[model samples]
Target: MDMNAYLSMFIDESNDHLQSLNENLLRLESEPEELSIVQTIFRSAHTLKGMSATMGYEDLAALTHEMENVLDLVRNSKLKMDSFIFDTLFKGLDALETMVQDIVGGGTGKADVTAIVTSLQLILKSDYSAGKAAQPPLEAAVTTVDGSTSASGGMLLDEFQSSILLQSIEAGLHVYHVHVTIRNNCLLKAVRAYMVFEVLERNGEVIKSVPSVQDIEQEKFDFTFSVFTISGLTQEELQGQLLNISEIEAIVVTALDSETLAVLSNAPAAAAAEAVEATVESSAVKPKAEIAREAAPRKGQAAPAPANVSRTIRVDIERLDMLMNLFSELLIDRVRLEQLSSEIKRSDLTETVEHMTRVSSDLQSIVLKLRMVPVDSVFNRFPRMIRDLAKSLDKKIELVITGADTELDRTVIDEIGDPLVHLLRNSVDHGIETVEERIAAGKPETGTIYLRAYHSGNHVFIEVEEDGRGIHHERVLKTAIKNGVVTEEQAKQLSPDEINMLIFAAGFSTADKISDISGRGVGLDVVKSKITSLGGNVTIDSAFGRGTKFSVQLPLTLSIISAMLIKLGSEKYAIPLSSIVETGILRKEQIINVHGNRMIEFRNGIIPLISLSKVLDSPDFNENDEDETEIVVVRKGEKWAAVMVDEFIGQSEIVLKSLGKYLTNIETISGATILGDGYVALIVDPNSLIK
Candidate 1:
């Protein structure tokens, strides 16, 4: 089999199963007695086991199998639930996840899990023995029924024994009679006997049956039944087939009743039942015989066969990307056509353009939606992570998530996981406090962390809020000063927000001790850079001793953006609409020089200005000939910077094309886009340009 083709599917399904297990385990910890939750966890483990086994990953299979066994013990009421048990099971689950990860990372999924496996096995064994001892009567009842024999002056035959007898007869071998008994708790004994008869008929023709047909039908038989059949089948095959039926007492096939068969050479099929009944009535049979029977049919039958479910075929992500690329090309053509139709001003051509516009717009929406996925797919794994972290740190913390169903472009989704993980680790390690500390501070023992997401006006906002000790502006400022990130004078003049922003400064840490959870002084800086690189912004809001919240705002998509096109000297530029505050034409007299730097006064504030041609090293044009320059006021965080351009062009949606890896060290230009005239305009990275 070409397993390589299924690799992506395997990764996706394995991830889904792991997420399910994690979420269910978190729920089980709170509602340990919830059998449904335990069952769900078991199902996930079972599925992962089957998948891994099929993939030839034995270590993953073995670990998941052990997890399933432990879950089974819990599910069946054999093992009592406790914190210790939960912890051990969670640890086992963690090991299984690690094995799966190893497989994902191109390894053989082999990990030394001998200790955990041994612990789970021992627990299972102990629980099984205890359960067996608790129901002694049940065991003895089964044993006695298994040992009883029929009284035809010959041994009675259990269903299993009868099956063997029939098989031997069919195989041209001598048939035998065996003793049989049924458990006292068995119900519907007559129905069970009938079912057994039906099975026996498959191998041979029944010659002599016991208990008189009327008495057997009226439930007058003891725990055992006898049958004589002639056929040519193997005893082993017959015994195996009968045992497969759910509840059977025992089977013993021996040489009894070997000589009791009267030749029915002239007898028809109708006489077989009567002959068996006569033999039983003539012999002295045991008065106390029990028969096990099936339970009554329930009200609701088994879920209507699962609604004849069908699955969707998964398409390759690469194919989707290619489709999106082709769509982008078509979009460019649409724009060109619209521009041409307007220039010509032909009524019929304009009408056709309008129709094409509607169709193309609809197509664009459908294509964009194809890349949309719910954020919950990523949020689902964190509950379990937070639970485990809280237990390890011996802290009481609550994780509250909202807007989990908010959707984002799949391209953005793929890169957001690591950044979110970093933020969450920071929350648990530094944002929340221990129970003792929280109580001493006159606050509730349990701290709350809120992770929220929502969409607004073509953008998405994700916020992480914690209600523990908030970020200390003084500490942040001091750290910045100590690390030489800012001068002492700069730190002194910083506002509270500016001081809080120092946390994202490189090499900044406020933790008293370095630990695996956080405080490595390498997290938030990377987080900030990552978000910024994705055309997003990260900001902090904090009140000392209250809590802190980090908000990240991102555009809806990255492939194409609505931008304001402008000309600087002879070159054109594209500024993302998401970052544009406002644009206006400014007379040359409105610009002033401050501290040897160009400045512009905008709405009562003197914002620093940079000429686009000067910053981008484009060919300098004669400012003497131009009457006025265009000013674009852009905001990075709290500060605004004005950009000078030669002329103002109208806004249009443009597809962003990356300048491949060959064009390294291009500082301020984020990407390039094609205009309707086939000219390439550079897209500006506002943050980099301003800094």
Candidate 2:
């Protein structure tokens, strides 16, 4: 069968199953006695194993098979899920995921899984209920479904195979058992079967065959053929050469010893019986794709059924992005028509333009909605991460999430993950306390970490809060002073909030020791910088002994915004309406220079005054020349800045376009927008302008 067509579907569905395995494993670990969770995990692993085998990724199948064995015992109540067992299973899962990733990266999905395999085999052999440890078995085999041991190391060897091993041993060559599986779509099965023999012959000598060499040459047997041979070549070199054959799907090359040869030749039927079942089962089972489809969501599994049977057609994201770009162009033309219609004072043109505006507004909503994805897609992976981290640190911490359903633009969603990870790790490593420390502080033994998101107007706010030891302001100040981030005298005037903010300073760390989790002064700075680059801001709030909360505020969408346009000298600028507090005329006399920077008193508080021309370095711009300037007040978190402009160009919806890649580092400008008259206006990033 051709596998290329199904490759994408395989990758996508495999990722889904891997996610299911991780989620179910975490659940099973939490509820060790829950047999149903074990069943769910088993089904996923079984399906994965089958799919991998079908796809010819033998290493992936083998690891998943070992995982299935452990899960099988758990579900049957034959083995317990202790911490050791859970750790081993999780390690297996990690190895499986890595192999899948290797396949995705165009590799053969093969990995050295000996260590993990040995661990799982130990689990299978151990007497878990009574807490007995597993010992090395002189002769070992996997227990099959019918409660029988299959001949693994030549126990099922035939007379011809045994004779060959003996001859090879006498010739001073190593004996090996090799199982060769032919590729599904090969030139000829019989010819390729001989090709396997050919490769072995070139390397050393093929002594005997399982189904007899005549049956193999005539293609009388199933797709797989086994052989016992003598080889002077090292196992690695021989295996690599065997894989070089085009029609070869899998190869299991095992070096055999004299003890195994003596034991296996005594019970050929029982040993051969083990190999017979796999062939018959493989032939009898439904096609690979069909089997994969029906094998998951077994009884007692929690798979939500939709209310209605709905049909969905997959559309490429590139197409959606193309549609959005075309609509943006249409929007620009419509704005130009609106401007022309208003200036011409024609009722027919005005009415037509107004109707078009209404229609396009609806289209805009749909396009933006199409680009909006729930933040939960990113939040879903965190629980499993937290679980593992908590176990590794030996800390009792609960990750409580809320408002995961809040939607954000996909572009913002993509960039937010790493920053959130940094912040969450900080919470886990620093914000949360150990069990003993929590007890000493008279708090609950288990620390609680809150992850939350919600939309407020045009922005989404995500908060990571922990109910453990909060930021120690004095310690932070001390570190800041030592790191030269602040002078000792400078630290004296800093408020608690200001002191907390110092944690985000570059290369800031108050940790006395370093661990894999954190304590290298790297996380918070990365979190802050990434959030800021996403046209967002992150703030820190702590209550000393109580807890700490890191709040991330991001724009709901990076592209397109309703802004108040302003004129600065001959150039026009835009300020996102989401950041605007109010627009007013500030008399030049009202702007008083306090310690060099111009400051203005508004209502009850004083705010720094920023001149647009001065910031942009406009030619012939004199801050002292204007009598009364139009001032637009913008905010960043709790801080505010009054920006002076020459005139206000009224409000309009504008598409935020990227300023060519070269202009990315422009501090005060987030992006550029096309005006109705075809002039480009710089959109001011208030968050960046605010000192």
Candidate 3:
């Protein structure tokens, strides 16, 4: 009966329902006639409302219940979908998400959602049936805004401004009434307003400003400002531009044509008569949130459940980590026992050790799988994000995701989400072109962004590719030179691929204007550093007019890996088997000197040869005078290298241990591992050596 005991469960379920609502609402917006999607959204909202009420989160429940009322009307065919309804619902979802996040951060799940609740109330009471048959060609057949009185120019236009907007609408251009809010903590309100106006002026003309452009520039307005503007850009594109400016909290853009504009100007007079009756009716009908609270079981009472519910239990990730650590110790002891059994040559002990090895190997597989989470957990949220970005950019982007089932270590998955988000946002904002540009270039109107993941060798590769405007080497070089990222002379000597790599330089950006999504010059650099910290690398490929692709290579698991243990003179070393191609002997005659660097031939190709003894400064033995030196051919992506070692001690499954924070000076050594003989062997990072 204690709510604290169920808090985690409530938070998790709330997030799940919220994600479902977001995805389904997007789906419903696209397929408005598809009532099944509405049903799905309704169920998620209903369940969330019930859960919130039961958990004593009345604010969360009330907002959801209001949303459910509008949705209920839509599902029953009493109301139809439109831009206004969609926008309002999306706003409700956003508010719900904020409240839930607040709760997750140990605050009460409460928000000042009076504005959103009022919008939902208007949608519930307004009579759209009058305009149903003769609704003008507006995005929203039924439209309204948030304010105290319906007459307030939240988007209300005067005679002249409305006339100009009407003329623009007739010319097939879009007109929007944007309500912009600056962040409460923003230091320079006037500066933020100026930037917003600059973005608006660049895209379209501002027909009217509520506080007047002069007042806004003088910082006389509060954190919020409203503007009526007309431009050829779609609502999404204009909104996207305004959102790019820093210190702006949120913006609601309502699309208006002559009819919607007229409705706005006259909505107050038309709806005044129904106000008293609607208010009475609204109070008469109880919201689902209150009903849910009333229906909730009393303390110590068991709630009934339907038969055949899926049986599952949530386990904390820390517990799994503890389990893995315990198993690692058992594995090390098992390896030691195997060595002892082989050395003693005892039949009983050998048989028991062999049996133990088989059982332990199976256990190892299970333990690893337990820590393996599908990349889908990260990929699922992307579609909704892409939908929003595509809207803001006024570009048609279809995100084609493949290999969502691909799995990675939990730690890797946790860290990979942010980088992938940056890459995906970069693809949408910069990689893809607008609808007009695509048509001008004779390409499909809708751009396709391919997000794929797959296993290559022992690593997982996640690629973000877009079939829009690709990277322009000349433009990149020019920007690189202008930003002082590279000297003009150095820029001239760089290849196209290298020039493209310059985009990842710290504080590097090619965007003409910064937006909320990417262009602050902090995206790809952070991505590169974070991926590298996880022992991974990222690469880029592009074709000038075709598109761009970013490939990220990451390890499958950070713990326990199959490694080839070799002796570097008297010191022991471990080379991850994932990095090695094959092992063989290289004679002194086979070694080739290329530009003062040791090189060797393998598989009809040549590669650099590195001496482990010299690289690690090992003093016990040197292979310089040896007749034939044992060698291992390793690779990083397409690059190959041959490593010379004194002896191969066979391959073994080893547990990787970090070399501690103080030992970071060794770039070529990734980590250390314990050998069967209880020796600490340093692991060589093949990727670092390939270059």
lDDT of each: 0.70, 0.78, 0.79
Candidate 3 displacement at residue 279 in angstroms:
39
Sliding window of 10 residues with minimal summed lDDT for model 3 = 140-149
TM-score of 3: 0.66
Write candidate 2's Cα lDDT for 1-691 as tens digits. 6887778777887888888898888888778898667756876786677667667787898898888877766765668789898888888888988998998998999999999999999888767733335433446554432233444554565554576577667777878777777767875776566667756765665555666554554456667777777787776556656765676776667776666667657754555455444543444333333433554478899864532244755567788788888998998999999989989999999999999999998988888888888999899889878888888888998999999999998889989999888888888888888999999999999999999998653578899999877888888888999999999888999887888899888989999986788872567788888887776788888897799888888877546688999887788888889889999998867878888978999879899998888888877556578788788888865788898888898999899887775776787787889999999998887776775
Model 2 ranges with Cα > 4 A deviation: 129-322, 345-355, 562-651, 658-672, 677-691
Against the hidden true structure, what lDDT does model 2 obtain? Answer: 0.78
The prediction achieving the highest TM-score against the true structure is 3
lDDT of 1 by residue, 1-691 (tens): 5677777677788888887887888888889888768756766776677667656777887788877877766765566677766777778878877876887888887989998888777777664434555652312111112222233223233334344444555556746432334455678565455545545554543434555333454567676765554434455445434443444565333332333333222233234334444544454333221211222235684422322145667777788788889988987887788889989999999999889879977877777778888889888878888887888899999999999999998877878877888888888888887999889988899999999988643467789999878887777777788889999988878888888888887878988887788872459899988887766778888777778888887656656677889887778899888677898887888878988987888888899987777778777564546678777888765668888777778888788787876663576777799888888999887765564
Cα lDDT for residue 588, candidate 3: 93
lDDT of 3 by residue, 1-691 (tens): 5899989998998999998998898888789999768767876786677667667898998899899888877765668989889988988999999999999999999999999999999987787433445544433222222221223223344555566678888888888877777878988786677667656755667766656554565467778776777776786566655665777776667676566667645544224224322433343233324434655679999965533255978778899899989988898998899899999999999999999999999998888888899999999889988988998888999999999999999999999999999999999998899999999999999999999998654578899999978888888888889989999989879988898889999988877888888872458999999998887789899997899999998877557878898997778899989789999998999888889988887778888998877878888878987999999888866788888899999988889888876786677787898877888989888766765
Best by lDDT: 3
Please state the error at residue 393 of candidate 2 in Å: 1.8
List ranges where model 3 is wrong by over 4 Å. Answer: 128-310, 566-648, 662-669, 684-691
Best first by lDDT, ranked: 3, 2, 1
**Residue-pair clashes per candidate, as listed?**
13, 1, 2
Model 2 residue 134 CA deviation in Å: 16
